[model samples]
Target: MDKNIKVGMADYKVASGEEVLITLGLGSCVGVIIYDSSKKIAGMAHIMLPSSLEIKNNSNKMKFADTCIDLMMDELLKLKVSKTSLKAKIAGGAQMFSVSLNTESLNIGKRNVIAVKEKLKSLNIPIIAEDVLGNHGRTIKFDCNNQQLNIKSIGKGEHII
Candidate 1:
């Protein structure tokens, strides 16, 4: 039987075989999914910021897009998953605040999505699916056995990608 492993905000988890990785409350944060189909390994990161470099003395590396991706890749490689076989799926990155004046800092959701995409591109990891950009929170479920990402939102029902 598959078990659900919860990944908290500003956190991540890696699982293989029958385990499923999940994360909740991804508002203005992104849930990044990296999976190796043949190895049946999956990883999920719920990132809160675009760059770790922008923040001084950052304690949690999992909270930033750049660092989170890097850390997740390290974990996946530790599991003996090939870098070339890695594929990505992204969710969340919502505009949770009503910004009267658009600013770079205020557009955190958009910034996170862009940063994640850029990081994946830099690593040569292809993004297979994405569910992003809106004014709502999200709960993500990643099934390692099937390599499917399911996204849930209030009033939006659920979607699989």
Candidate 2:
């Protein structure tokens, strides 16, 4: 374990060695995690919004769905993870904004899921699984050792990681 390594919100963390990175409190936010078990490399991102098209003068473009994937992909590549060997798993994207909208078009959670799907498709990275879209919040953890994903909510039961 690396004492210098830490986890936080609205951020993506990766571990190449034995270190494991995690994040939590994902409400209306999406957690996109990519892992390569062969290389013991894992990355997790907590995205708050669907697209950055709304963030005027956006300097932190990596915080958006489109760029976050790209950013994490680049980091993985830098770590020598093959694109074909990499797989994605996502969670959260809850409709917890408290504003009602048509689930088809106006829901930011759906939009985030759609954008993530499209971007991953464009990148040729297949998403293996996901637990997304709901009115409740979620907390996700990714295990680099086994490439397992864990998800928990306020009232839901704990899942494997």
Candidate 3:
């Protein structure tokens, strides 16, 4: 049986083998899934913002793409998963509201996606798949056993990456 782990908004979770990780209601937020097929280790992060530097809160590292990915990498390393073997699948980062059309700060989804990609590149983690940048929200499920990322949206239905 697969153990389902729920990753909340601005949070992250790690799993191995047949475990499944899920996150929901991603609008301007992004869901990042990392997996090592050989080790059967997987992690999912729900990032609400692009950078931690922009905010002074200093709380909730998972709320920022840069810090969130770093935290997840540390956990994966602790679990004995090789960094070189890690691959990523990202979803969400949608432009949910029309008011965010041209505004930089309000267009958080685009910023989140850019920051995520930059962070992943810096960490040498290749993003193998992604479903991003639209006008709707998303919910995602990451299967550790097969490294399959299942993405679902209200009007978009479902897609596997």
TM-scores, all models, native as reference:
0.96, 0.88, 0.96
Candidate 3 residues lying further than 4 Å off, grouped into runs, are none
| C-alpha positional error of residue 30 in candidate 2 after TM-score superposition, expressed in Å | 0.6
lDDT of each: 0.92, 0.77, 0.93
Clashes of each: 0, 0, 0
RMSD of each: 1.2, 2.2, 1.3
Clashing pairs in 2: none
User: What value does the lDDT take at residue 66 in candidate 3?
Assistant: 86
TM-score of 3: 0.96
lDDT by residue for model 3 (1-161), tens: 64999999999999998899999999999999988999999999999999999999968888999899999999989999988888999998998888825568789999999999999999989999999999899999999999999999999899899
Off by over 4 Å in 1: none
- The deviation in Å at residue 30 for candidate 1 is 0.2
lDDT for model 3, on a 0 to 1 scale? 0.93
Q: Provide the lDDT at 4 for model 1.
A: 89
Tens digits of per-residue lDDT for model 1 on 59-146?
Answer: 8999899998899889899999988999999998899989999577789999999999999999999999999999999998999999
Error of 1 at 40 (Å): 0.6
